[model samples]
Target: MTKYVSCRHHSQSARSEHQGAVMEALEGGRENAIYRKGELVSRPASHWTMTVHQLLQHLHSHGFAACPKAVSIEGGKELLTFVEGETYNYPLEGPIGSLMALKSAAKLLRRFHDASESFLKLNTQDVHHWMLPSRSPKEVICHGDFMPYNVALEGDVVVGVFDFDTAHPAPRIWDIAFSVYGWAPFKTDEDDKMGTLEEQIRRAKIFCDAYGCTRLEREELVEVMTLRLTALVDHMRSMAANGDAQFQANMEDCHHTAYLQDIEYINKHHQAITLGVLGEIKF
Candidate 1:
């Protein structure tokens, strides 16, 4: 990550060593244009940040610190407290790519869901428009994209989860499905490193155990997974049709085809997938 010394600090340019993590925009986050400078990261705020900010503040007060603390918005960008840790970027390998890492993510997500129950009462006014509507009365805020790259780590432990751009109110199963796709990576094997289907399902079951989902929730897993992927394909196609540069490129690159294939596999093996999730792991 290259450093970016601010023009305001022209007089102290020679003392550049005093700067914290330099103003380098880390890639891999598809939604926000993010840049890190010193002890702060600046990114353009959206309709969701305000709601997310309130949620983070609440979570912080309630003993959850796995997310960036909202600082202030200046110059059309919101400044956030920089969390120091290695991000689990793409093509996950080694310790960071193991089932234990997935377990940590599940635990953190469980904590967030537990804490987020009070968020609605705290901020009843102007719910963030970006949040998807609740499927029913029983819903919590889903991180939307709780993938490997979004999680930060120290060794194999997941320390932080960034990228709140997709936070929304939805069923617990909805969030679980999304996490399974990105973390368990339910997609078709795009790399030789991807484990066998049984291995993947076992890992998914491990995640569920760590999350402590009930038997009923376990039964709902496969269906939710299918629905999540189907909706994703629809959204991607819609985005591409709407002329989104990213989605257009994804379509041209056959990402859509890959997603469809994954959905088909999940549906074909729905019964087995449920059994895998429901089966007890003997520690």
Candidate 2:
């Protein structure tokens, strides 16, 4: 038998040191999620939570205010300051679909990578965390799951990023690749609501320009796109194999196959993508 706990089921008593804040359920966290009293968001703590909290604290100290601030652990859930804005999910369209938005997303990621350099050695791999530690040579803590859906918007401006469960040590290119893949969204023409292949390529370059990637980093862009998503496919397989219920369902729905398809597509057009984003890949 399984026990279920509602977000509202636990709170401080009237006479206790802490007072209850009403928890309103948020729409999109993969884990159980609720926002307390309009100021704090709460989610079940995983082995990675403590480490993620530490990283968030470090980022806050550095002047990047785009991510959540860790608050406290209460009722077995991790409490965090709620970032106010909108998250554009898959099939990204609207202001975020524009070239300006793409540039904003890229610059934001650059800011994250710049601020993240200090935490490279701090993330000593914990034995119980589910995600893998990155092994890149020019590593910093990459926001491993950066996507349009996870980005927060303030009107037409890209203001913040959320969902840090997958943050880990990796090269700046690791996050930059996904920033392009998710925003310009490097997908088949049918799935790309943003624009034509030529337009997508054009916009991808704008993103790279805004990110200020060095010649060598631009040289490695397409390859890192392949590496990043292929690792996602492998991670999905491992999760399904390890009996993760949601991953099992996603595998059944051919989610890994879809990722593999995109990986193949990215590899197939590797040269084009390279040229499209960087004009010419420098060795």
Candidate 3:
């Protein structure tokens, strides 16, 4: 990570050393550009940035400190405190694939949802905006993209989460279903898959149990997962058609095709998955 330092505060050699470490820590590929200076993360500001910042502040006031603190916007960039810890993406391996990681993520997600419920209760204004569309029965604000890549981990324990760009008002199950897809790794893509279908189903059960899901939520999980992915595909195509460069590139690369395949995979095994997560049938 390259560290950016003020010329007034340090010698040339010290600044270079800081820049290298900081930049290394911040490096990763995603749809949006991200930069870091000192302990602040900088990303392009959007019309919804202030609304998201309000939600973050609400979470913090309610004692959920595992997320970023929204700082000020400057020069068309939104700044947030850089959360410390290692982040992993697809192809989960080592600590990322451990049982501890799965359980911890589920627990943390539950905490986040509980805290967010109050936000929904308190904020009655219609001035808020989110990148993702709100869903039916908006019980709590959903961390719309609660996947492995979006969380920060210390060893096998997930300590923090980031990327509120996709945050939206949705049901708790809506978020959990997509999260299970990522962590249980219900994917056919060779680059992202971690286990066989049976293994994935088993992991999903572990996640549900850790999160203390109701039987109703468990029964609805498989169906919700498929619907979520379908919605994702439609959103990608719609955005690409509307000239969003990131989604345009993704469409060109046939990223939507991969999700379509996963959707089919889930549909094909929907019955087995429903039974497995419900503990009525073993995987």
Candidate 4:
């Protein structure tokens, strides 16, 4: 029989000495361990169980304040202070708010990537090696799922990023691609519930401009975004077929349809989107 632990029932007294805040692990699903305080922090078991504490320790050593400070817990669960904020889901009703959120996401990515660069010199192990077979080389730590849902917003502004399960060492472009695919509004007209293709492209440009990405980076960004989007759709399909409830709900929500639509949109307007992002760069 499988012994189940209630993350929610876990006491606050088990928290590590490094953390001065109250924290608790939420119930259900080992994919990520959730905590509540001011905001919810979702730390993936795959990454958090292996290296998140060390990663957080390293970040603190480096003087970074944006990431969650890891704390020890009973039953080997990790604890982190919840970052209070709103989540960006559905559509942004206004144009200005949409643009601002995208720009904010880009800035956040810049900070994450800059911080990740420091890890390159460290002797970190590749977590992916223990997973399925993949040709991608493990490099700097990549926030695998840097999408709107994983980010927390306050007053239409991105304030904190919560989920870090997909966090692993991979090419930095992979992280950028992940963000662009989602925040760039890389969805089809059918998928877009509140805006047009033109509006999405405009927002994408704003994000790219805010990041100060180079022309080469823009081109690579487009390519990687396309590849990652395709791979993600395939991965979700496989998971849904395997009776994964979350993946099932995601698919039932017409996610695959939206993904296909986005692919169609990309094929039809790759040149335009590429030029739009490149044009946004000042240098």
The candidates, ranked best first by lDDT, are 3, 2, 1, 4
User: Which scores greater on TM-score, model 1 or model 3?
Assistant: 3
Q: Measured by C-alpha RMSD in angstroms, how accurate is candidate 2?
A: 6.4
lDDT of 2 by residue, 147-231 (tens): 7766777777788887787887778888888778767667753454456657767777888899898878878988988888888
Question: Model 2: residues >4 Å from true position, as ranges?
Answer: 1-22, 29-36, 121-130, 189-193, 281-283
Evaluated at residue 48, the lDDT of candidate 1 is: 67
- The prediction achieving the highest TM-score against the true structure is 3
Question: What lDDT score belongs to each candidate, Candidate 1 first?
Answer: 0.70, 0.71, 0.81, 0.61
Per-candidate RMSD vs. true structure? 6.1, 6.4, 5.9, 7.0
lDDT of 4 by residue, 131-164 (tens): 2222266546676777666665667677666545
* Per-candidate clash tally: 0, 0, 11, 2
TM-score of 4: 0.74
Q: TM-score per candidate, in order? A: 0.85, 0.85, 0.90, 0.74
lDDT for model 4 comes to 0.61
Over 208-259, each residue of candidate 3 has an lDDT whose tens digit, in order, gives: 9999999999999988998998988888888889998767877877888888
